[model samples]
Structures are given as C-alpha cells and as structure tokens.
Target chain A: MTALLERVYAWRWSVLPPITGVAMMAMIVGALVAAPREIIEGEVQRLMYLHVPAAIIMYVAFFFTAFASVMLLWKRDIRWDAAARASAIVGVFLCGIVLVTGAIWGKPIWGVYWSWDARLTSTLILFLIYCAYLLARSVAGPLDEQAARYAAIFAIIGVADIPIIQMSVRWWRTLHPQPIVFRPDPALPNEMLVVLLIGFVAVLSLATWLISLQTDTERAAQRVSALRAEFDHREIA
Target chain B: MNVLGAVVAKDLKLAWRNRSGWLSAAAFSTIAVLTYSFAFDLATGDVRPLLPGVIWTTFLFAGVFAAGQSFQDEVDDGTFDALMFSPVGATSVFAGKLVANLIALLIIEFSQLILATILFDVALLTPELLGIVLIGTIGYVSLTTLLATMGGHVRGRSVLLPVLSLPLLIPLLIGAVRATGASLGLEAGTGPWMLLLMVFAVWATLAAVLLFPTAAEQ
Candidate 1:
C-alpha cells in the first residue's frame, strides 16, 4: 500500500499535467463543437462550460483549504499548513476566474455585467472572503506559526458561509436562474451534459495539479529556510 | 460565567476610561449621516424610502471603527498577550470583548439613528425600529468582533477589519436593511429578515467561540 501510494505521488509530478492538458484541450473543443447551444441563450451559453466548472473548482479548492486547515490545527504539522496555504492561493485565483467568466457570460445574457442577483452576490462575497484569507496570510509573515494557526481557524469559519451562499440563490428572489444541472431531475440535454462533465473533470484535475505544485514549492522553500537557519546557528557556535 | 462577567466588566471599564474610541466612532457616524442627508438633499425629497439603508450603512461603516477599537489598546500595549496567558479561557475573553464591542456599537448606532431621523425629517423612533436595530447590531457586532481580533495584529488593521468583516456581514446587512425597511413601513414583512439575522448571529457567535483560542494564542 505504501509503495503504491509513493508511486502514485511520484507519478503525479510528471504524468498528471500532460493528461490534464489533453483533457482541457478536449473539453474546450468538445464544448465548442459537440455541445448544443441553448435555444434561448445561443452561443453565449457556452460560457457555462468554463464558468460553472471554475465556480465548482473554486469551491473544491476552498474546501481543501478548510480541510487542510483543520488538519493543521489538530496535528500542528507544517505540511498541513503548507497544503492549506497553497490551496487557498489557488482557490483565490480560481475564484477570480469564476467571477470574470461569470461577468462575461452575464453581460450578454442578463443585459448587464453585474447585478445583485443572489448567486452572483454570494459568489462575490465568497471571492471577498478568499481575498481576506489571503490578506490575513500575507500580513502574518510566512514563517509565523501563529499566522498559520489563525488562518486555519479563519478558513474553517469562512467555509460555513458557502452552504448559506448556495441556499441564498433559492431562498431569495433572484434574477439568476436556478440550477439545471444538479437538480432532482436534470434539465440539461445529453450533449451539453457530456461536455460539462468533461469540463468538470478537466478543471478539477488541473486545479489538483496546480495545488500540488504550489504545495511542493512552499514545502521546498521551508526546507531551504530551515537549512539556512541551521547553517547560521552552526557558524555562530 | 464569572470569568465572562469579569472580562466584560474589565472591558467596559477600559472602554469607559478610553471613551474617545467609541466616541470617535459615534462622531464619525453622525458626520456620515449628515453627509448623506445633505448630499442627497433629503429635506426637499421623500427620504422615507432611503432611511433603512442609510441608517444601516452608517452603522456598518461606523461599526468597523468601533470593532477596530475593541482590541486596539490591548494589542498596542501588549495586554493581549497577558490576557491570553491568564487563567481565563478564550471563550471568556471573546465573550467579554463581544459585550464591550456590542455596547460601543449600539451607542454609536443609536446616536446615528437619532441624527438620521433629525437630518432626514423622519420619525424612526419606535419599538419595532429599536428591536430591529438591537437584533441587527448584535448580529453585525458578533461577526466583526471576531474579525477584529484577527485583524488587530495585522498592520493596516483599520482598513483590514472592514475588508475582512464586510463580506461576512452581507447576510446581516441584508437582513438588517430588510427588517429596518419593514419597521419604517417601506416593506411588507420582517419575519424572514429577522430569522436571517438570528441565524447569522448564532453562526457568528459559534465561530468566534470555537476559533478565538486558536486565534488568541498568537
């Protein structure tokens, strides 16, 4: 089990990116070609393939941040902190993409680039929370354990907002349309569904790859700092 | 319970001695209300429709300053470390800060309400309005108090507090504005908004209680 796990971890560095790259290319081409246009929204609805997946990825990234944060707090392990920080940075980046793509999609369909529709507003707020988390991380200094601890707590607290944000779309009177994909009976056509599934898988894989890369970089930096501190101490001795 | 009360008493005493912190918040709020009323020329128009939003916005902005003040002295003087090192737990410290901050915010909010009424020529003083104000302020302050604790150690915390707290406070703001609108006869029902405010308050309080120890250890 351990050897297999190690092999998978080692392979993640080389094989995952190319696979993700191919999947992304296929998703884009398939979304543009194979996916049927909405009768109402036409070509503009195509943005859904990117926008919805980005939004979903943003959620996934933050959830990872929150989960990693919990682990950090419980274990006092720097690796958990590294994972949490990397995921948060990636989460914020993906959230920004979600917002931009959403605005692009909304401009043509909603007749305005921005509105206080419940989903948009909630997503905007989610983006803001991510920004705040990053800010908290930045101001605390990189090597500060207190910062990591506090950030973990903040991440855990911040995630409680997600479910509420999701529900707000339904509970409130919103200009945004209700879910057509994940409903009790999905209304999405088969072709669009297939394309969207591709988009989801591709984006999710890319996000995972990005987060792992970031975590590895952060961990390496910490190791370098630790070695430098040791060398300095030896020289002083 | 005693620990909580003692913490609250100590905070209230500190706030009393350093009245300028909350006083400045109130003064800032009054200026904001006056600026809004004058800028919009509320005297010549029907300002009734805008009262709820104006009042809540004033409180929200003003509350940031108040929240920042909640821990400024302790953080600056290094008493925050002392408090954390004390025998009392994080919950007591958080509860104490919450009560102190709530009192400070309510004072500013009430004064803002009075100024808003006078400036806008609207009679906003009533039991319903007071109830909405109390509930809304409690919810807002609960969340901001926690954020303020985290932001207090950060440089540029004055700016950081609002940036950190505002997004989380959106549900509270929406509920307050809607409920306040109902109180002012500009809206039909307040039940849903009140429920939202209550949920927000409970959630924020739980988050603060659970997170404060980890946050305060720094």
Candidate 2:
C-alpha cells in the first residue's frame, strides 16, 4: 500500500498540472460560451459559476483541514499536520475568492458591495478564523510539535463553531440568495449546470494541486531544518 | 482539596490579589457604555434599541480580556509547566481557569449592568437577562480559555487572542445580543436565541475538554 501510494505521490507533480490547466480551460469555455446568459442577471449572473464553485471548494478545503487535524491528533503524523496547514492556507485563499466574487455579484444585484447578511457574515468570520490559524502557525513556528498539536485542536474547535455561527447569523438576518444548486428542484438550466460542474472540477483540482505542492514544501523544509540541527550538533561534538 | 478546587482557589486568590486587572476591565466597559451613550445621545431617545448591543459587546470585550489574562501569568511564571506536569489533568486546569475567568467576567458584567441601569435610566437586570448573561459567558469563556491556552506561548498573543477568539464567539455574540434584546422586552421569542447560546456553550465546553490536554501538554 505504501509503495503504491509513494508511486502515485511521485507522479502527481507531472500528472496534476496539465490536468488542472485543461480543466480550467474547459470550465472557462463552458462558462463563457456554452451556458446561456440569464435573462434577468445577464453577465453578472455568470459570476455565480466562479463564486459558487470557489465557495464549495473553500468549504471542502476547510473541512478537509478539520479532518486532517483530527488525524494529526489521533495518529501523531507530521504528514497530517502538513496537510492541515496546506488545506487551511488554501481554504483561506479560496474563502477570499468567494467573498470577493460574491461582493462583485452583490454590487450588481444588491446595490451595495457588502451586506451584513447571514451567509456573508458567517463566511467572513470563517475567513478570519483561518487567517488567525495561519498567523498562529507563523508566530509559534510551524515546525514546532506543540504548535502543530495546538493548531490541530484549534482547527477542530473552529469547525465546531461553523454550524453555530451559521445558525446564529441566520437568526440575525438572511438576505443572501437561496440555493440554485444542491436543491432537489434544480433551478439552473442544463448548460449552466454543466458549466458549474466544470467550474467545480477546475477549482477543486486547482486546490488539490496547491495543497500537494504545499505539503511537499512543508516536509522538505522540515527535512532541511532537521539536517541543519544535526549538522550543528555534530560540529559541536 | 482536589486539583479542580485547588486550582480554582489559587486562581481566584491571584485574581483578587490582582484586583486592578478586573477593575480595569470594568473601567473599560464603563467607558464603552458611556461612549456609546454619548455617541447615540441616549439621553433623549430610547436607549432600549441600543442597550442589548452595548451590553453584549461590552461583555464580549471583557470576556476576551479575562481569557487572555487566564494563562498569561501562569505562562510568564513558568507555572503552567508545573501544572501540566501535575497529576490532575489539563481539563481540571482549564475548568478551573474557566471558572475563575467566568467569575471575574461576571463581576465586571454585573457592575456594568448596574452602571448601565444608572446611566441609561433603565432596568437592566432581570431573571431572563441574568440567565442569558450566564450562558453567554459560559460559551464565551470556554472557547476563549482553550484558545488562550493554545496561544499562550505564541508571539503577539495579546493581539492574537482577540483575533483568534472574537470570530469564534460571533455566534455567542449574536445569540446573546438577540436574547438580551428579547429578555429586556425589546424583542420577542427569546427561546431560539437562548437555545443558540446554550448550544454554543455546550459545544465550546466539550471542545475544550477534548482539546485542552493537547493544548497544555509540554
């Protein structure tokens, strides 16, 4: 199992980039050319393709971070920590995209660039929480085991907070658009749905590629730090 | 006394000895309320609309301040290391500190409520409001205590505490503010809001219990 996994890991760098590129190109064509423009929202409605997919992938990334965090705690694995860190970083970035794209879409529709509505506010809070997680990693030394453990614990707590944040914010106010996707009734047309699926593939593939690169970098940096410490110790002896 | 009682007693004593810490928090809350009143000119108009927001925001800040201080002295004096090594457990230390912090914050909050009543000329304390305060503080202190422990050794913790904690506490803040409004007759249907607060508190407490050991481990 380990050998097969190692082989796949080795080939991922070569395999992922081209696939992501092609997927992204396909999504772009599908979104811009294939999908018919909405009669009401026009061009700005197309932002939904980007905004929705990014939002979906952002949730994927953060939830994956939470899962990795739990694995890191339970298994005592550096790889899990690396994955958590990488996913969290990617999640924060994707969350930024979600907020920005949503704001752009909102300006065309809601007459303002921002709203204190339920979903918007909760997403904003999630973004801040993960930003703080990254900040904690930097401040406490990413290589530190205690930092890793604490980060893992923090990630779990953050995930737990998400539902409560949603519930509370929801009770506070909810003006964001209802679901066009993920419902039984399926509001979107077939072409738009295909484009959205393509966007999903593209964004998720991009996120996976980024997380893989980051995980490798983190492990390599740890190796370099370990080697330096060993070299210093030997020299002193 | 067992670990929990001893730690709680020790912390409460330390907090009493450092009376000015919470006094300063009280002072900050007072200024915040006063500033809001001045800014909104609550003297003439209805302060009811503004009262819930003011109360919860003040308590939120106070919770942040108290939770930040929860681990600072222990970390600074290297007593946290000893406590971690002690036979009892991280949960005990966490619960103790949580209780201590909760007591300190409640004191500050109670004082603030009285001051609000006097300044705004409104009845601020009622049974439902106190229940909301208790539950909100529980939710607030639980996560903040865990976070404070997690961030104790990190750099820029003073800044990081609020940055790390306030976002997590948004649900609590939302629930508390809305519930406070309801309890004070500014709004109706406090049940769901109170349920949110209770749910948040339970969630935070369970997370702390499950995570504090790892967070405080050497």
Candidate 3:
C-alpha cells in the first residue's frame, strides 16, 4: 500500500501533467476536426462534442473527490483530506463549466437556457448536495481532516445521484436526448466530435493542473494557520 | 432503570424550574405559527390546497426551536459529560430526551394545529383527522429530536439545526403533510407515504440511539 501510494504521488507529480496536456490536445483536435457537421434548430450542432465531454469530465472530477474523501476517512491522513478538498475545487469548477456550456447549447436546442424538468431538477439537486459538501468542509474549519472524513462520507453518498442524473433522461423520456456520443450511430458526425474531444481534453488538463496547485497550497495554508494560532496563544499567555 | 429515571426526573425538574427555558419553546412555537399564518393566510382561497405544507413547515420548525434548548441547557450547565458517564445506558438518556422533546413537540404541534385551522382552514379536528395529526407528529418529533442534537452542537446553535435538517426532513414533512391533508378528506394516507413516515421515525430513532453518545460525550 505504501509503495502504491508513493507511486501515485510520484506519478501525480511527473506523469499526470504531461498526460493531461496530451489529452487536452487530443480532445481539441478531435473536437475541431473529428466531429462532423450536423444541424440542430438550424445551426451546426458542433457544440455537442464540447458539451458532452465537459459534462463527463465534471463527473470524473466528482469521482476523484469521492475517492479522495474515502481515503481521508479510512486512513485518517491529512494529505487525503487535502486531495479531497482539491478535487472538490476542481469538481465545482467543472460543474460550473457543465452548467454554462449546457446553457449555451440549450438556448438553441431546447429554446430556453433553463427548464425545471426532472432531469434538470436532479442536476440542480446534485449541485445542492455538492454545495452541502463544501459547506460541511467550511464548517469543519481548522479541523479539516475531521471535516474531510464526514464531507467525504457525504460526497460518497451524494454521488449515488450521479447515475440518476445521467440516466434520468433514459429512465423517463424528458426533453433531454439519450446518450448521443457513445452509441454506435452517435447523433453527431465525426468531424465535430473531434473538435469537442479536443475542448474536453483542454478542460480536463486545466482541471488537473488547478487541483494540484490547490492541494499544495492547502498544505501550506494549514501549516501557517496552525502556527499563527499557536503564536497568538503564546502571546496571550 | 433507576438511575435513568432519576436523571429523567432531574432534567424535567430543572426544565420546570427554569421559567424561560420551558416557556422559551412555547414562546418560540407561538411566534412560528403566527409567522406561518401571516405568510400563508393571505393566499386563503382554498387554504386547504396548501394546508399540508403550511402546517408541517410550522410544526417542524416550531418543534426544532422548542426542543433546541434541551441540549443548550446541558452544554451551558457543563453537565453533558457527567450525564454521559452516569450509570445508565445511553439509550435511556436518549429516551429521556426523546420524551422531553416529544412533550415539548406535542405542545408546539397542538398549538400549530390550532394555528393551521384558523389560518389554513384545514378542518383537521374530526376524530380520524386528529388521529392522523397525532401520529404524524409522533414521527415528526422523533426525527426532530435526533436532528436537533446534531445541530445543537454545531457552530451556530439554533440557526444551524434547521438548514442542516430541512433537506433531510423534506420527505418526512411531505409525507406528514400529505397524510394530514388526506385524512381531512376521509382518505387514509396511501401506503408509500405511511412507509416514508415510518422510515423517518426509524431513521431518527436509530440515529439518536447511535449519535447522541457523541453529543453526550462531547
């Protein structure tokens, strides 16, 4: 286990960045070139590639948050808490990207930027649960690891909705289409998908870079805060 | 049993002796029902339409406020730790607290029901209707007591309890409200709603049994 962790941290430092950067470039080329031209509501539906991948990456970010939280709770390690919080930062950002890009796509396709249908409502609920996760972390304050344990507990429970959120359209036929990118006869053409795939990689690499920076900074900030508190107490005494 | 009962009696005596502590709940409950009245009564057409929602919201919040101070008193007196180590199982401590919260909740529930009648025009006083209200309150109070303990220990004593609890308590509130409303029409609440209420009751009771030790020990 220790060797595995060392490998993870080592790869996280050296290998992940280049891999992420390469993935982003692949996604961009895929989006701009690979996805084929298609029409939705009279305009080219090239955004499909970008939108779907962004949403998928957001889910990936959430998975990491949940996974890191599990490690925090199980191992009682501050580093796991840091990683979990770092992932939360990325997850929230990716969630924002999902909402924004989807809104941009929805305007032309769905005729409105928002709808209160079950699919949308469930998505909104997922957002709220994530907000609750953030709130739980903030409330835990300097006891970040303790807070991380419970926050991760909630994150783990909360991710159950991800499946529902994803398949809500399938489970119930709402305005949202079923999976368009993965099926054999994907709704979009190959060219547009290439550009979208590129856009997704760009976003994913950006997310990973930001998470690494955030996790490193959190460690520093925690140390500083502990020292400050100790100094304040000493001065008072 | 003896020690637990004695502790229960002690808590009840302490509560009764503190004029404001016991009455604090009554005062808070009264104000909460009035606020619901002010908010909902204005849309008074078929006040029955929103009766379940209105009544449940008032009762739930009122019960939260009513029972919130039970732990605050324990914490303030610095007796929570001692109570935990007493020669009694923690479940009895929970039962005692549950009883106090239940009685306090009943006071608030009945008061809110009165407010619901005058404000929301819910004709819930028929025998069957009243029984439904009693049962619903039983489920609601059980959940609230457990949640209140969780909330009462947190950063903001009173404010934290409701926000943390409302998301969870929504299903319970929905079921109770629906049951209360359905009973008014001589229709028994359907199976799923009743099951939800039972689930909530069991969840709250189990959480209380399990988690109250953390509060008591803290």
Candidate 4:
C-alpha cells in the first residue's frame, strides 16, 4: 500500500498538469456551449463556473497552509515550514483570483463593482490575512527559524478567524445570495452542474500542481542555503 | 498572578514614564473623529447615526499606534530579550501586556468618545455604551498585543502591525459597531452583538495565551 502510494505521488507531478488542462478546456466548452442560460441572469451567470471554483480552490489552499503550519509547530521541521510557506503563497494568489473574479461577477449583477455584502467582505478579509501571512514570513528574515515559528503561529491564529468571520458575516445579514451551484439541492441545471464539477476538478488539480512546484522550489532554496553555509564553514576551517 | 500583576505594573509604569503611548492614541482618535465630522459635514443630529461607526473606526486606528508603541519600547530598549529570558513564563508576559494595552486603549477610546460628543454633538457617553466599549476594546487589544509581539521585531512594524491584526479584528469591529448601534438606539437588538463581543474577547484571549509562548521563543 505504501509503495503504491509512493508511486502515485511520484507520478503526480507528471500526471496532474495535462489532466488539469484537459478538464479546464472541457469546463469552458461545457459552460459556454453545452449549458443553458439562466432564465434571469443569462450569460453573466456563467462567470460562476470560474468564480465559484476559484473561491473554493482558495479555501483549499489556505486549509493546506493551516495544516502545514500546525505540522511545522508540532514537529519543528524545516520541511513543514517550507510546505506552509509554499501553500500560503499559492493561497494568496488564488485568493486574488477569487476577489477579482467576484468583482467582475458582481458588476453586472449587483449593479456595482463592489458591495459590502457578507461573502465579499469575508473573502476580502481572508485575502488580507493571507497577504499579511506572506508579509510576516518575508519580514521574519530568510532562513531564520524564529521566522518560521512566528509564521506558523500567525497562520494558526489567522485560520481560526475564518469560521468566525463567516458566522459573523452570516448573522450580520443575508444580503449575499445563497449558493446555487454547490448546494445539496443545487439550483443549477444538469449541464451547468456537469460544467461546475469539471471546473472544480480542474481548479483543484491546478492548485495541487502549483503548491507542489512551489514546495519543491522552497526545498531547493533551503538546500542551497545550507550548502553555502557549510562551504563558508569549511573555508574558515 | 503576582508575576502577571508585576508585569502589568511594570508596563503601566513604563507607559507612564513615556506618556506618549496613550496620549498619541488619544490625539489620533480626536483628530480622526473631528476630521470625519468636518469631512462629512455631519450636523449634530446627523452625527447620531454615524457615531458608532466613526467612533469604532477611530479606535481601531488609534489602537494600532498604541499597541505598536507598547512593543517599540521593549524592542528599542532590548528589554524584549530580557523579558523572554526572565523566569516569568510567556503567558504572564502576554497577560501583563494585554492588560496594559487594554487600559491604554480604553483611555484613548473614552477620550475619543468624549471628544466626539463635544465635536459631533452626539450623546454617546452613556453607561451601556461604556460597557460595550469595554468588551470590544478588550478583544481588540488582546489580539493587537499578540500580533504586535509577533511583528514587533520586523521592519516597517507600524504598518506590519495593522496588516497583521486588522483582518483578525473585523469580527470585533462588526460586533462592536452593531452593539454600539443597538446601545445608541439606532438599531433593534443588542443581545447577539454583545454575545459576539464576549465570544471574540474570550477566543482572542485564549488564543494569545496559548500561542504567545511559542511566538515569543527564540
């Protein structure tokens, strides 16, 4: 079982991107051609195919960050710190996509580029927190263990705020429309549902690919730094 | 408890000597409120509806400067290292600083409230309003102090402090504004907002206590 898992993990880098590209193309075709227009929203509602999936992917990225951060704190391992850092960077990128797409979707529908609606507000806050996390990591000084520890702690605290923000925003109002696509009783027609499912799969794959690539780069950078330090030590000796 | 008191007392004395921590916060709050009052051209009666948001927003910005100052003193004087090395555990240090910030923020907030009443002509100085202020301020200060400690040693700390803390403080802001609105009779129910404030304060306090030691460690 472990060997099979290892094989799959090894193949992931090679396997993911192509599958993600294919799924993404399928999602686009499905959204634009196959799916019927909404009775009310018409074409603009199609943005949900990308916008909702991006938002979901952003959440997944942050969840990975929080998980990796906790692992770093518990294990005190540099690898875990690297994983957390990579995940947070991707999380921030995905969060930006979520916000921009959300604004684009809101303009025609809400009749304003922005509104103080709860979901948008909470998502904005989430984006800010992710940016802060990256800023804290950068300011912690490169290769500083204390920086990792601080970043880990900040990540944990920031993640804890997510649920509270959601709850508070929900209680504050129902101004933001309820989910129509991913709900148990999905309001989407069959074709739209199929497209959305493809979109989700494609986005998740893309996120995983990006995170893995980032983690690899971080690990390589750490290795180079360690090697440089060792070389300096040898020269001194 | 004794150690925690000593920590609070020490911070209070340090703040007293510096005097600028809370004073600048108060000044900032006053300037912010007055500026808003003028910029919006809000009449006395018009100010009543805007009171809760304007006051809370002012406090949020003022608290950032105040919280940043508390750690600036420690870091500049190299006392942060000393405190970390001290026999007193991290929780005591965190609690002491949290209490000190609470007192300082409340002072700034109250002064701001008084200034708003005078300048904006809003009657926001009632006892019930003060109660909401206490709950909201405690949660805000607790989280800020913790974030300040984390980012205190970083460059551009004044900017970094707010960036780190503001997102976490949103729920507090929402709750405080709602509760304040309810208290001022601008809204209907205070119960939910007050409960949110209490939950936020407790959660922030607990998170800080549990996490500060790890964050403070070298």
Best by lDDT: 2
Q: How close to the true structure is residue B61 of candidate 3, measured as C-alpha lDDT?
A: 74
For every model shown, what is its TM-score relative to the native structure? Answer: 0.93, 0.95, 0.75, 0.93
Query: Between 3 and 4, whose TM-score is larger?
Result: 4
List CA RMSD, all candidates.
2.2, 1.8, 4.9, 2.3
Q: Can you write out model 2's per-residue Cα lDDT over B123-186, one digit (the tens) per residue?
A: 8788888899999999888888888876465667788788888888888988899998888888
Measured on C-alpha atoms, candidate 2 has an lDDT of 0.87
Interface RMSD of 1: 1.9
For model 1 the TM-score comes to 0.93
lDDT of each: 0.82, 0.87, 0.64, 0.84
Candidate 3, position A70, lDDT: 65
Candidate 3 lDDT over residue span A94-153, tens digit each: 777667767777887888998755555555555666776677667765544445555665
A197 in model 1: Cα distance from truth in Å? 1.1
Off by over 4 Å in 4: A1-8, A230-237, B43-45, B151-153
Ranking by lDDT: 2, 4, 1, 3
lDDT of 1 by residue, B23-127 (tens): 888888888888887887777868888778878888999987788677778988999989988999778888998998888787777777777777777887788
- In the range B124-186, model 3's lDDT, one tens digit per residue, is 667655655566666656545654554333576477656544554544665676666666653
Query: In model 1, how large is the Cα lDDT of residue A203?
Result: 88
Candidate 3 segments exceeding 4 Å error: A28-33, A41-76, A105-107, A144-212, A230-237, B1-29, B40-44, B67-70, B87-95, B126-157, B174-189, B200-218
Interface RMSD of each: 1.9, 1.4, 5.5, 1.3
Please identify which of the two predictions, 3 or 4, would achieve the higher lDDT against the true structure. 4
Ranking by TM-score: 2, 1, 4, 3
